[model samples]
Target: MNRREVLAGAGTAAITSLAGCGGVSGLFARPTPEGVYVPDHVEGMEMVGTATLGDVRVGLTYSYPHRFWTVERDGDGYGTSRVDIADDDTVHLMAVPWDPETELVLPNTGLSVAIRTQGELVSQEVIYPMLSQRMGFHYGANFPLDGDGTYEVTVSVGGLSIPRYGGYEGRFDGAAEATIPFEFSADALSAIPYRQLDERRFQPGAVDPMSMDAVPTGVAPDPLPGSQLGRGTSGDAVFLGSVVTADRFGPDPYLAVSARTPYNGLVIPGAGLSASVEGSGPVRLDAAIDPELGFHYGRAVPGLTPASDVEVAVDVPPQVARHVGYETAFLEMPSFTLDAE
Candidate 1:
């Protein structure tokens, strides 16, 4: 299995949505009875410190890969490509619940946590953990670390309601905060071996490699209709659509997507959409309601250049009001090189 398969096999994709704000509360409301079982310590991970705030106890582990890999922009967020950890690379902050009895894998109460370090506030989100299966929960974030030194990490967790499985509907009193210190050294980082997938678990021909051409594409309608890129598969019966930006240095490329099924194409508005070009900074594709097309459109600013190859990744939220859209995974387009105008 490649990195994508390995990551996907590790566990279920994390649901990052808020209640009421979008209609995501009900989608993942029911929790699985099978709890997560994760190991306490690994050979390479250094135990920094442990603290108990309220009901939840947190253990911070510090570790880095021998050779870092960059995420491939080709539609697959779980997939990876070759890239170096720059001088200011993000330090992996893995948060594991210290209590053996408590399953912190999926917090049903909308509990959200974030880390403050290096004068930055990093929100805790779904991060692929080391020894994915052995790590039960998805509570970690990548923070920037400058060179070798000691850094203070502060964790703050709070939510309005208690976990649904706990059989509580009242306000929760488990809000708490804890700070821990971590040290980093270049020598220690270099000594760490690369985390490789088990060769025995590798099943040849189990899954096909990711290809850009594999994604379905179409053309925009009427007037200045341009080449359109789309992913038909999404949450439930919803379909996503976008306009593959024309190769020009003018307006940034835009993607117009709506939550609709093939049978019913009623435009689902207010859905968030963002795109990123590999190596380049994040391209802001703001949402614009297109009544004519019956879909919400987001145009990329400061567009792209032609003849140069680029990989674009599109992220669509799972819930768009009542309409269920795509999951947490990104839709990666093939390496696109525009024809000379």
Candidate 2:
């Protein structure tokens, strides 16, 4: 219920604290403290929280384990062992088990640390086992799309594990995203770096296709990369005006605000504006509005109605003209610019 708590849980910045320090603050901070957490004190990295929405106070916890274990009956006696934690988005933890006598080198106690999600799991060869290397990292995907579902996030390191279910319990407009805290450390909440897993991250040391995989996909696109999206000014965009200029619009009349802008990409309403891509591509059309401003369709894509008073300024951009099928609507400007009120 506190503004500071809301800010901490919602921002993308990493929390600075030490994991396994055995407290609330350490469990939720960036740059976890040294010598705080050990192999014996992990419940598998869990995220726990309490909240009250209206009259309903949410008191719940979710848990996940890095690896599952099944007991095998050996002639009436049972033995417990490790099971696989697959799926790429598996959560990982940093457990530096130093020699009990000394407190620096690594230990080979048949235990390791890891994080897990619904997608995949990354293992030990990638996660060095030692106190000499003591920085933790997190990777996440399958981000919650709506505020009506639950997610299982688990962290396991040095035989101890913690699990917590992060949930969404409200409605939100605009582009949706939220920050989920980690059980081992708060940095886990915001340290999830989003990189295309299936595609190449970058070029390989100035090498060409021979040394690596750099061949272009076969089906050639019409226009090469870096081509101008369209002609004319971007402020002069057009769309089918949903509201009537005189409060009596009969048919869905289209309005072109920007004189010309046609590119193959996105047109986020609040993000300045995005023109068409390849003349025809996917666009995220929204209708959230601000009464004082133009009908806010989004950051880039905007406007609820056509400019009834603003006159046409210039010839339509060829790309815009062709894409909107507006060849006949091209009328030279009698008053090139809009008059200020």
| Number of the top-ranking candidate, with TM-score as the measure | 1
Per lDDT, the best of the predicted structures is: 1
lDDT (10s digit) by residue, model 1, range 1-341: 22223334444432222212121222233321111111111223456676665655666665542222223334533334322333344455555542223322222212234544575654344343221222222244445565677666665555423112122223234667777777777666545432332331222111111111211111122222344444443332234444545333135554444343222232323334454433566454454322233224445544443322333333543222110111212223222221123
Clashes of 2: 59
Error of 2 at 134 (Å): 29
The residue pairs found clashing in candidate 1 are 74-332, 75-331, 75-332, 251-303, 252-300, 252-301, 252-302, 252-303, 253-300
Candidate 2's C-alpha runs over 4 A off are 1-231, 235-249, 256-264, 271-341
TM per prediction: 0.36, 0.17
Tell me model 2's lDDT, rounded to 2 decimals: 0.24
